[model samples]
Target: MAIVREKGAMRQWSRSQRQCGQRIALVPTMGFLHQGHLSLVAEARLRADKVVVSIYVNPGQFAPGEDLDVYPRDFDSDVEKLKPLGVDIIFNPHDLYVRESPEKNRESGHETWIRVENLERPLCGGSRPLFFRGVATVVSKLLNIVEPDVVVFGKKDYQQWRVLARMVRDLDFGVEVIGCPLVREADGLAMSSRNVRLTATERKNALAIFHSLKRAEELVRSGETDSSVLIEQAVTAISNAGGKVDYASIVDQETLKSVDKITKPSVFAITAWFGSVRLLDNVELSNN
Candidate 1:
């Protein structure tokens, strides 16, 4: 249960592990651990000899009025939960994007950023314009700092997983990116740190997101290949359940472009707002 808060220490530890011929896996997180996050840790544990879990709430990922200030965080609780799971190191850096100094913390002076281009332009990217740019830049920093053999991400953020995978490939990162299945609560609401912020009624209303996707799945299975029909149905269902639909898209799984039909592998991805909390969920669709 070693907790590392500095990049140099983390890189040193990563180098030491490599010297011992140990394979390392990184499970980057924003703290406030839930079962969904632990699932990623479990996958990381199985894939590599050492697991490094990062718990930094990246400010760069949030826009002007987003939940960055109020995002849930419980570092001590997170450590206690991961202790039982055999996490080798917790890379909880104070701030990875800024330069640290005693007089005053200042910017890193680097204006560069990474973008996966097309994959980030739709869905969540459509609403949160800066979201993927911030995500890609910070994740690039993490990959460079940890230097793990592989990195794990939850498919709950389907676009994010795709974006990072594309970034790793385009930038020639020497680490494998693995996306685990999206986990949900018993009632079908996708597990998220922001789930705690949902009021009782809002939580109950959020079930429509899951049901909408399930209905979309049923439609696709029952010969409804029209992408517009699926998107309309999903949007209507969520809106009727007291949630605001952000985007209900049926897009090609790889290119992430909205498709006219389910001619190839595709995913029905949805993002909606339950109260002030924005949640994402998706279902893989194929004409079967």
Candidate 2:
């Protein structure tokens, strides 16, 4: 596999692949890859002739007090994991991938941002205000730079996947945004890079997020429709399991806005603090 670290090199590599009639698949990620990321790579391998993975921890997606400085990094290990996956090129750009302009830094000038209006203000957005703006902008840049035939994202980030899909459609980016299934551990925890930060006890407590979501699913399946009661029960389950609850509520699956009554299909999203690490999980309920 070829490792291209600079923007110029990646563009050149992408052009060469296109000239050869090789369809390109791009998997954008922040480093410290796990099984979840590899699943996306595997899906890319099946969908396109050439797979390119970009490993850059985006600073814009992180909030002021978030774990930007402390986010994990292990390029050597990440490469080892990708080498066997048949990835053709790895785009690991320098700090300049997306940086504040000198003028912007000097006087707090406005940095260019991409926002999906209604979709960016709910669910995770309620807590992390600037998260999707950073995500949409970086993803747009990656799509433009790589010019891939398709880009893959995990369904674990359901809202993100939806936002990107909408952004691509609205902006007329001629690349298919593919959403893969969430890969989970044998014990049922959704695979995440942040799982490494959990202490032994915290790890045990983290399972509450999944279990509570499961409970909510069971209630919905049994014909219960009260959104308030369902959310209260899920939050109670998480707290009983020793997690500091952030928010657990049901929202319209498509719009992501909180729904007072479950007249239609909805998604239940839960976020909680297991020790100091924040974790999120969701379940989709549909009649079909």
Candidate 3:
């Protein structure tokens, strides 16, 4: 795979692809490549003639006191993983690519931000205030820069995926957004780049998030309709596993508003802090 680092070079490369009538697919990531990321790349390969992956550890997306400096990154290994996936270009740009506004450009200013209302205020949204804004802004920039026919996101980041879908539809980006299933570990924990930071004991405890979501699903399937009970069971499971619970609730899948009755399909989203690392997971509970 050819690594395109400079913006001018990447734009030139993408222009050449467009000139040749090749449909392009873009996969935006924050480096620390894993199976989940590779899975997206593989999917992109199938849908578009040319696939471009961007590995920028976005600083804006990270909140204050978050792991911005030590988030985990290995560029050589990431490149090695993408080599066999037939990735046409790896757009590994510096901070300037996405944070090129006058404020960010100035030596003493902060990064430019982006936010979508209603959707960015609940679930994981409450904990990380600036998170979605950073996400939305970077994603918008990537879409504009790559100008791909399709962009792929992993469903593991369900809220982010949903928010981006809404952003694209509302803004008319004219690119298809595809959500891939959550790839998991043998022990059933959803695969995540942050999983690298987990200790042996913490890793075992992390499985509780998945288990809790499963139990919530079982309760929903067994004709239990009380949203509070399902959320309680999930919280109990995660706390029992020694993880500090953040928020566990069932909300409308599309609107993301908390629901008292499971009258329609909803999502059981959970977030918790395991040591210094924060992890999140969700399960879709459909009454249809």
Q: Quick one: best TM-score, which candidate?
A: 1
Per-residue lDDT over 122-194 for candidate 1, one digit per residue giving the tens place of the 0 to 100 score:
9898888889999999999999999999999999999999999999999999999999999999989999999
Instruction: For candidate 3, report its TM-score.
Output: 0.94
What's each prediction's TM-score? 0.96, 0.93, 0.94
Please report, in order, the local distance difference test score of every candidate based on alpha carbons: 0.92, 0.87, 0.88
Model 3: lDDT to the true structure: 0.88
Q: Candidate 3 residues 1-288, lDDT tens each?
A: 798888777878888899999999999999889998999999999999999999999887888888998899999999999999999999988644434466564655555566788899998888888899989998988888788999999989889998999999999998999999889888888888899999988999999999988888888889988999998888888898889988987899899999998999898888898877789888888865
Compare the candidates by lDDT and give the number of the best one: 1
Backbone clash pairs in model 3 (N, Cα, C under 3 Å; residues 3+ apart or in different chains), count: 0
RMSD of each: 1.7, 2.1, 2.3
224-273: candidate 2 lDDT, tens digit per residue: 78888888888888899889887787888778888887788788888899
Off by over 4 Å in 3: 95-112
